[model samples]
Target: MIATVVSSYPKIPNRPSPARLRNAINRFDRGAITEEEIRRIEDEVTEEALQQQAEAGLDLVTDGQIRWEDEQTYLARQLNGISLNGLTRWFDTNMYYRQPVIEGAITWQKPITVDDYRFAVEHSEKPVKAVLTGPYTLARLSVDQHYGSVGALAKAYAGALNREAKALQEAGATLIQFNEPAILQHKREFEQFAGLCRSLVDGITVETSLYLYFGDAEGIYPQILDLPFQLIGLDFVMGAKNEALLQSAPFTKKLGLGIIDARNTKLESVDEIAERIRSLAAGLASDQIHVSPSAGLEFLPREVAQEKLRRLAQGVRQAEAVLV
Candidate 1:
């Protein structure tokens, strides 16, 4: 079994915080700080985030999305015909995301995250997985003035995502993940959601995965298993019923078991986590399981997040040892 993060990792200690970064951006915008200084800060933060993932003994690493303002706005602003509109509470979290405004036909004019993905690949010792927000989530979070309906908007965004995924694949990314947390909110559109995701990955050759978090997936179980993804990630921490759902469904693809809680500050017991992994492995097989936090580790403090990563890696290792 391998360990990896779904997306953003918490900022490291004593480093320039997100608030500081935003302030720097504000200064740069107002011509108080030079563009070169902002780039230098971004590079430094990304390098540290990569180093922390590698140090955690993770098999797959990400840039920790340190450069992103939030999940939606960063990528939304990068695409053509889309702009950052206003703030909205992201799900039930205290954090806010800049709601995307669709002013015209959405198109992928240029690579948004390819440069960042390449930077992570260049800095990290381990293999890096390129992460992107899924089309459904992007469409759902956006204020669609151009596209008539949510389905139409999602499909348009799917094409853009497909183009981006292929670009990342050509840039030497073997693993690509599309995070669709919004799917849990719209369970009635399971078939349409699956079709949109299929269109997003249509002809991409790289290994692909889907990560759903922040909500229970009990209602959409079995149906989601039918999606064409090499791996499927589920939040077992937030959705305790997922264990039974997995038993009831026939899951053949790789399973990214989110056993660690990322939102809470309380630490998880390595032994208990390992035991749960052992139980899941009894039916799913240890080789098909990949362990990670239930969601991004950005909510917790730096030290606590680091400890969680260590515990996650240790717990997975211990579980695999028991299976061996």
Candidate 2:
């Protein structure tokens, strides 16, 4: 069994203390510091994020996305022909992201997250996973003036993202996960989304996962199993509809159970998590599962996020003990 994060980790400074990273950003905006200085601060926070996950006994780690802005903007600001505009509320949450505006053809001009992922692999004792905000979510969140339709824009984004995914695969990453929470809301677009997903996942030998969070996926349960990803991550933390899948038959592919809440600061019940995994014993083998939060920990305080990691690692261990 493995303990992993679905996508991001928190970088918020602890309360009552000034954060060097935030301060650096302020200075950077004022032209008081260089981009390298800003990156140095990001590196510190990324190392801290990876170190805490290791200390909590997690087998898989991410860069905590310290160097980037929000998940949506991180890729949009980089890809060709897309510009970032005003902040908009993300999904039903209070959180906001710089809305990506599609003004022209979207293309991947260069490497996006390779340097950060490489740094994570070098610093952590455990294997590192590279995460990308999937094309469907990006298309839904964007202001589409050029593509005329979300499906067309998503397909273009997928073509670009496929190149980026190949870059990560060649960079020695152990896992590459695409976050596609938009599917939970736009369930009617499953066919369009599925075709794009199949093309994006083609030819990647390393482990790949489609991480869906922020809502339930009951509408497309068994049908989603046909997609090509080696693993499917479900958001049991967000909706009861997802947890209901535990009563279904065994999963053919590997699974990721996002039972731990990332939005709430309260630490989870270890016993409850153990039971959740136990419930999945019928549907999945213990080794075929990855335990994680419903989404990124960027919604919580830094300390709370680390504690959640500890809490999750503990729960996974307990589940393993009883499952044996």
Candidate 3:
């Protein structure tokens, strides 16, 4: 229903010498620093990023995700009935995530996104989106101890996520996004997972969005048409190039077209990104598109991340101007 700018997730890659991120991490890990201190660091980073968005002319902004351990781990830690183990290697380099080992039926220890929403509401002038890892993706990535089928586990996870969603909405979150990168890995499971999420939030007034990254939308086109979300975010940089998926799927949900590459360190040019948007607009209605990065900015250097986001906002403005 609205045009906006979104981040897949932004990170504060280790800062420069003397003013290092390690200083912040060390204090927190050692219990010498307070949560307020960590928040202060996040606030400072968020302020700079938001300013960049405003200058580059964007409608929506994220907190840059300086407060999270990882995109999925934030909510994974809040869920009950699971033991979170330290991240293991899923790919090359240090890429990792909190592995939720199912010990029993999953439920939340408390409201997962309330503090995140509260921080954004109090600190940010632009509308804030509360993000969550989708149930299907979570189940697929983690090991299930009790639930035999991934489908059954996904339903349980979705129910728990719905509770979190309700709490986030009540907390004044303007938008909620379910980040589902694993959707590209398996189509059938992703469809089932997306359906359960829709069922849980049925009739709810919240503006729910499903965010997919790292792969194409081809596999999930059949299910996306019927999903209850008001918006859908995709990683256009890494997603399949064919336009058939976009043409076939109903564009009822606004498209969060990720035009910027988040994993790469090289900054994208405004003109270059605008080209991607131009392509997307060929099939998607103008009003249906929102510009965004492809994945978490944590994968890129902090300076590179900031520059890419700023460029993305600029690209959006340029595209909007031409479209108008």
User: Evaluated with TM-score, which candidate comes out highest?
Assistant: 2
> How many residue-pair clashes does candidate 2 contain?
0
Q: Against the hidden reference, what TM-scores do the models get?
A: 0.95, 0.97, 0.88
- lDDT, candidate 3, at 34: 90
Of 1 and 2, the candidate ahead on lDDT is 1
**Full ranking by TM-score:** 2, 1, 3
The deviation in Å at residue 113 for candidate 3 is 1.2
Candidate 2's C-alpha runs over 4 A off are none
lDDT of candidates 1 onward, in order: 0.88, 0.87, 0.71
Off by over 4 Å in 1: 12-23, 26-30
Q: Pick the candidate with the highest lDDT.
A: 1
Q: Candidate 2 on 163-215: residue-level lDDT in tens? A: 98999999987689999999889999998899999888777888889999988
Q: Is candidate 2 or candidate 3 better by lDDT?
A: 2
Model 3 lDDT per residue over 188-244, tens place? 665476578776675458788888888787866756756788887887778755255
